[model samples]
Target: MSATLNPNIFRAYDIRGVAERDLTTESVVPIANSFAAMLVDAGSRDVALGRDVRASSPRIAEVFRQALSSAGLQVYDLGIVSTPMLYYGVSRFQRGGGVMITASHNPSPDNGLKLLINDVAISGDRIQEIYQGAQAGRKIVADGGAVHTTDILDTYVTELTEQACIGPRALKIAVDGGNGMSGPSITRLLDRLGIEHIDLYCDPDGDFPNHHPDPTQIDTLVDLQRTVLEHGCDLGLAFDGDGDRIGVVDEEGRVIHGDRLVIIYAREILKEVPGARIVGEVKCSDTLFSMIEKWGGDPIMSRVGHSFIKATLRENGALLAGEMSGHMFFKHRYYGFDDAVYAAMRLLEIASNVPEDAPFSTLLADVPDTVTTPEIRVDCPDISKFGVVDSVVSHFRALRPVEDIDGARIRFENGWGLVRASNTQPVLVLRFEATTDAELNAYQSEIMEVVTAAISACDDSV
Candidate 1:
């Protein structure tokens, strides 16, 4: 029963890797056993568990349940639910902890676990500890912890509807679930809110037959844009594989970036709660931070990742926090966890109040324009990405002022360039923003030179 676990799968945010290679049923049992032991050691008697519709999910969930029960921890299995719902269930039921069997936008061939301890998303050193325990072949053998099957979809939909503010505008929306986990929850929530919507790829198919579930990639949103335009809908919304992140399109079939979405959401929320603190990831546009301040609310920059941002939100008592990758967390009227379906509903509520003559783009007309790069993901070996980041950080620190908040964000006079290791993928994430095209190019060139040099040095050393 002692399978060698891949330490790389124990990522900064969650556990993820190729299902066939890193997440075999045998390997998953040890992980689950370690998780259950962690909960039991912390005095948690019960756990709320859920999974996505991936092919490996059922087997993984069953093995996990067995492990939990074996560790003397009751398991409330919410079969085939989204990541957000898993978080909601744990927080709602006041359970000791929860585990979501999902990879959240990773490809169909991949699967992973999103862990929660005491209602907080677990990450960093805690995740490392789990890996260490599993490697040590640690097992907690106990007796008499029962497993119960439960459905929280209806309850989740009802709760979100109660807290949502649906505008009186009878708007038409087109939603593409990308054969991920968003369809059922979003459709139900929209139905309860009395809004008209068209569903595309709403059925949860683990194969992801229509397209990859990651809407942040422009190509993935093509079908959604076509659907919105063809249906003449007022908006189009797309969700990742686990429904925790969202990608949106305006009425004119234009994909809206996360920073722009923040502007719209913050404008509405600030009107109601003036001076409320709002947070955006370090990768977000500078305009977003400045605009939040202009709107009379404090803007706090945070490290990317839902777990990190959620912790920051609570620490600052911020009502809202978002990332450029589409993870939007709202604490205004809902839980602090990132929930895309709820965010889409909130977007609709905001759009309904806009004048008929204006478009969603108009809502952000006042924001200053700047040249920025779409998240540039440079592929690196999982073993080397972190080293690459560290090397780059060291190289840049001697040249310009660098902010190592999450990564090295080298600030220049006109703009800033970021180089960081992606927590979820084996890639070095890079982004740059500048006041003009020339300044943007200069900043990008300077950072690219350092990154290339560091990567080469890393490879040479290896």
Candidate 2:
């Protein structure tokens, strides 16, 4: 039977869609079969699979597993594990590839698949090939494929605890999983690491009864910040829906953004692997690049997306890479998958080694302060967002000097502004960084004006 895929659902980086409308069983089964066929063609007979805490994930994963088994592939079901765990399983088992059923920071109503080939992320143009193969009914089915179930929770915890460099510091920590897939695994790992802490919303609930699973949004971390302050914990950590990304709060209950977290991680990583290459997305603060260089490491900027970051890291042999959205990849001690649980352990290890008075907040103290706007996204049609960015880029290039990295970054004497199309959402993303708040506001206003003008131009053309 041929699989039907909505062309709209085949995105640039991964497969994601609302479960009810875009990812029905009919659409998923054949895709899974085709994926298994792809693996067979690549000489891979065994594949690992995992899912998140969303209600639809279990059903969807089952259908996919059936397809894989029917196609003559061995399926290792690491049930209800994080995306990172799936990656680790694939790398550890030396299997063909892995699939993670998750919408990753999306709402509970959404579900999707993140595919890996030989432990490397499959994205960009490769996603198109997979969709095309599935639609053409070109899947292979053999007689030797089998399905097996195994729980890797204990192994995962042991790996994280062993990798962490924690010391004798009896620090109190607060962890908020937002009722996502990270709860059980993170709690287990923390306990094994001998860390004292409070766990909030650590129950696996698809309903997300506490708040949305996305920790990048300030509102989502409000409860976590409060919990840390109330408990007088040394710090706080929060994970997204699939537990692949992390957001942090300091001992003083101050929220730390991903760029700052990267700085902290980079500093610690440098101690172990000096002069290593580190990569950051275009959205990261300029200070990060400077600091990495000052620490005798090379800093490379890449497009925003975990796939892009991972591919770039592999190509450049980078030790670490991160984005402003809390996706961090580490290659020093483990495979370079973005794992928030592992990241939290690394942070704790670094904190344990620091002076008694030195805190996580101190990592950012030496960098010059810059006023910047939090990533502001404007809702627009998916088709319109990219065109709007192109139009804005053209206009900015004509009117002033701009850096066309991942987007149009207009440079001024005291500040810089950027406007880009979000790869993961139907929105236009805007950010500004400046020497002063007033300069930052001016740059933001100017960029807004340009973006507004570009939208008008597109509207007129339409």
On lDDT, the candidate that comes out on top is 1
- Could you tell me the C-alpha RMSD of candidate 1 in Å? 1.5
- Report every candidate's CA lDDT: 0.89, 0.86
lDDT of 2 by residue, 103-202 (tens): 9888889999999888988887888888887788766767877779989988888878777778766778899998888889899988888888898999
Per-model TM-score on C-alpha atoms: 0.97, 0.96
Off by over 4 Å in 1: none
The TM-score of candidate 1 is 0.97
Model 2: CA > 4 A from native: 1-4, 398-401
TM-score, candidate 2, is 0.96
Candidate 1 structure quality by residue, lDDT tens digits, 165-255? 7665678889999899988999998889888898899999999999999989999998889988898888899999999989999888898
lDDT at residue 399 of model 1 (Cα atoms): 86
Question: Where does candidate 2 have its weakest 10-residue lDDT segment?
Answer: 1-10
Error of 1 at 377 (Å): 2.0
